[model samples]
Target: MAETHFGEWIAAHYATLWPELFDPALIGATVGFLAGLAPGGGSALEFGVGTGRIAIPLQDQGLEVYGMELSPAMAAHLDGTGVEVLVGDYATAHMTRTFDIVYLLRNTITNLVTQDEQVRAFENAAAHLRPGGCFVVENYIPRLRDRVFAETPEHLGVEEYDLATQIAVSRHRWIIDGEQREFSSPHRYVWPAELDLMARIAGLRLRERWSDWHRAPFTAASTDHVSVWAKPFSHSRAVPNS
Candidate 1:
C-alpha cells in the first residue's frame, strides 16, 4: 500500500503550521482560477487535495468537488466540509465518474519520488478527465540554479540533487514554539519540457503555461509554473501527439 508523507501530527496542525497557505486571498485566487476553467456546474477532481483548502471553497463556487488524498489523517479534516474524498494514491486511483477538470497542485507530483509514479500520475489525471477536459498542475521550478541550501532564523533546509537520477533529497529543520522539528524527504524533480512529454504520453496536449494563477507570462526568471493540458475529444486512445 502507498503511504503518505503527511501524518497525524502534520494533519492536525496543518492550517496553524502553514498559515501563509491558508490566507483567504490566496485561497480565493486559486479557487477563482480553477473555477474559471470549469464550466458552470461542472465537476472537478483534485489530486492530493489535502485538507480541502481549495476544494471546499471551489465547491462553494458551485462546482462539484471531489478529492483524492493518501492520508486518512488529512482526509479527516474534510469531514462535513461538503467535499467528497477518496482515500488512495492519486497516481493510480480511479473514480467511477469522470470530471470536467482534474488538477494537481502545490508540487504534489514531486511527492511521488519516482519518475514512473509521476508519469502514472499524469496518466491518471488524463484517465479521469472527460473528453476535451483539462488537467492542471501547479509546481515550483527547481531552485538548483539559485542555491542548494536555504537557512533562516526559524527554519533551515538543504537540498541535494542527483542529476543522473533526477532525484532530490531535502532535509529541513524548524524551530517551532521554541522546540526543534525536523523532516527529510526524497523527490523527483521534473522540468517543464519533461512534464510536457509526460502529458503527451498521457494523450494530452499543452493548452497553456503561466507563471501564476493570475496568468502572468512564464519566464526564465519565474520560480513557479501552472500548466494546463487538454485531452483530445475525438478518441480516448488517440495517438500521442508528436
Candidate 2:
C-alpha cells in the first residue's frame, strides 16, 4: 500500500492557513528573479507545489509553472489553478520536456528523509533543466545551540550528533487543537559547500546564493540560504558564465 503524505493532516486547511504566519507575496516576488518569472519568460518546475501558494503567483508573473506534488489531498487544491501538477515523487517522476528553472522552496527538500534521496532529487532537477537553466533551493540551517529541546507550539528536540555519520536526529511533537502528533524527521542538514558538491555531482554549478528571500547577503549570522545552481552550457567544460 502507498504511504500517506506527511502533510495529509494539514492538507485540507493549507490554502486558508498561514496568511499571518509569513508573507507569501514577498517570497513570490523574490523568487521570481530566480525563476525567470517575467513577460514571455521561460518555464519552471516546482518540486513540491503545495496548494499552488507559490506556483500560481509565479504563473501570474508570466512564467510557465508546472509542479510535482506527492499528496492527492494537497494536489486537489491545485485543481483549476492553471499550473500543471504531476503526482509522484520528484526524485523519479517523468516528464517529456525540460525547464528553464526548477525550484524546491520552503525547506521541502528535507521531506525526502534521506541523503541519497536528496541527492537523487538534485539529479532529477538536473535532468529536467535545460542548458543554462537554474535549480533553486531554499531551506533553513540547523540551529544547534545548547538547547536540548525547542518549546515552540510545535515541539522539536535535538539529540547530540553522531561523530562518525554526522547526522542529527530530531524528535518532533505537535498538538494541534488536542489532536496529538509525534514523529521523527531525520535530516542531513546541508552546508553551502555540501550543496555545491551535490550540484556538481548532478552536473550543475552554483550561480548565486542569498541569506534570505529579500536578496540579503548571507553571513554566519544567517539562519538559512536561498541558493541557485545552473546546468552547465557545456557539460564537457562544466563551467558557469561569469
Candidate 3:
C-alpha cells in the first residue's frame, strides 16, 4: 500500500473504465438503496471509493455519502465534488464517526492479501457503524475450477488459485491495443460461508444476499454476489484477535 500503484494506474485510465463501470443507468442509486440507504435519507460510507464514480451519483440521489479511498491518485478527482473523502489504507483507516450504511464494492475487500487482514477489516467496519447499520459487500464467486492460470487484456481472461487454503486469486494484466506496458494486479477471493463467519465474528448477521444489485436469486451457477450483513440493535458487539 506504499503508494497505491495499481490505483494510480486505474485512475489514469478511468476515462475508459468509467464508462464500463459507471454507466449502468444510475446503478449507484440502485446499489445505495440496497445497502440500506432509505428513500427518506441516510448516510453511506464507501470503501475503495475510486474516482467518485459511484459516489457522485449516489450523492445526487440525496444520500449523505462519504468516501474512504486508499489512493490519493484515485481520490484526486473527487476534489470540489462535495463528497467527503478520507484517503488512507483501508485496513487501518481512522473512522471517527459512524454511518447508517457501510459498503465495499467491486471486490474491494480482496485488496488485503491475507485472511487475517481481511477479517480485521470486517471487524473494523462493524465497529465503525451506528447500531442497526448494514455492511454490504459485492464480490465475485470463486470459480477457479478449470482456470488455474490465465491472462487478461492480452487474452480477455481471468485466473489464479492457491491450493491447501482455498484462497483464490484474480490475476489480470491489461496490455491493451496501444498501452505502453502491461499493468496487473492480483486480488484474493472469499467464499460465501467465509463471509458469514466474518459477519458472525463482528456481531452481525446475514440479512439479504443476491446474485446481483437487481436482487436476482443467488444460485449455484451465479458468478457474483451482493451480500448484506446487518448490525442488529440487540446484538451490537465485536470480537478481537486472541
Candidate 4:
C-alpha cells in the first residue's frame, strides 16, 4: 500500500481528532516563529508537510514557505492556500529552490523505515538549502522503549477535550522490536546520534539540538527531539533557485 494511507487517515479525521489531541495552533505558530528566527526571514521549505498543519501557520508568520509531501490527498487540502505543495517523496524529491531554512516536523522523518532512506532524506534536505541555511527536525526521543518495558504505563493523559465528539484520545509511546528501539506509534525510531551522523554525511553541520520547541535541555525523560543543522555557504552552488 502507498504511504498515502497515513495521510488519508489523518485528513479524514483531522477536524475531529487533531484539535482534541494536540494544540495545532500552538505547534504551528511555534515552529513558524522558530524557523523565522533564522537569517533571511526564514525563507523555508518543509518535507512531509502533511495537510499543511505547520505550513499554514508558517506562512502566517510572514515567511515564504514551500512544501513537499508524499500524499495527494493532503496536497489537495492545501489548494487555494497559495502555499507551494508538491506531492512526492522527500528522499528522492528534488527542488531547484534553496531556502534559508528546511524542516521536517511531526516525527515524519521516521516514516522512512530504514537507515539508508533516512540518510537520503537528510541529503535531499541539504541539497535544497542555501549556503548557511538551516535544517530543523522535530521528533520524540527513544525513551519509549524503556517506558514500555517498565511495568508502569507512561501515562500520557489527555491534553485536551472535545465536548461534541466525546472521543478522548490519549498519547503514549512504547518499545517494540526487541527493545532495541521504541516508537510513538508503529514506525521505526531513530536516535539523535543517528540523525547527527546522517547530517554529517549530508555535508551539513549541527547547529543545535533541543528537547522541545522552547529549546528545553534534552533529558532521559524528555519525550521530544528538536535538532537544527546548517549548510555552509560553500555549498550554495549545489542548489539552484526554483
* Per-residue lDDT of model 2, residues 1-242, tens digit only: 12334466568655333342237666665656655522367799999888877787777777888999888888888899889999998888979999988899877776675677778899999999988888999987766664354566644445455436545666656665666666554555666777777787798887888887777898999888999888888775345435
Residue-level lDDT of model 3, residues 154-173, one tens digit each, is: 43344667766655555444
Worst ten-residue run, lDDT, model 4? 154-163
Q: For residues 21-94, what per-residue lDDT tens digits would candidate 1 score against the true structure? A: 78888888889889999867789999999999899889999999999999999999999988999999999999
lDDT per residue as tens, model 4, 1-242: 11544556556655444353258756755665465556445678889887777777777777888899888877888898978987899888898788888899877886776677888999999889888888899876654324332232322322222334322222343333223222233345677887888888888888787787777788876787788888877743233222
Q: Quick one: best lDDT, which candidate?
A: 1
Candidate 3: residue pairs that collide: none
Instruction: Point out where model 2 deviates above 4 Å.
Output: 1-7, 15-25, 35-39, 146-184, 237-242
Name model 3 segments beyond 4 Å from true: 1-5, 26-29, 146-155, 165-169, 175-177, 235-242
C-alpha lDDT score of every prediction, in listed order: 0.87, 0.74, 0.73, 0.69
TM-score of 3: 0.86
Per-model TM values vs. the true structure: 0.93, 0.82, 0.86, 0.76
> Which of the predicted structures, 3 or 4, would earn the higher TM-score when compared with the native?
3
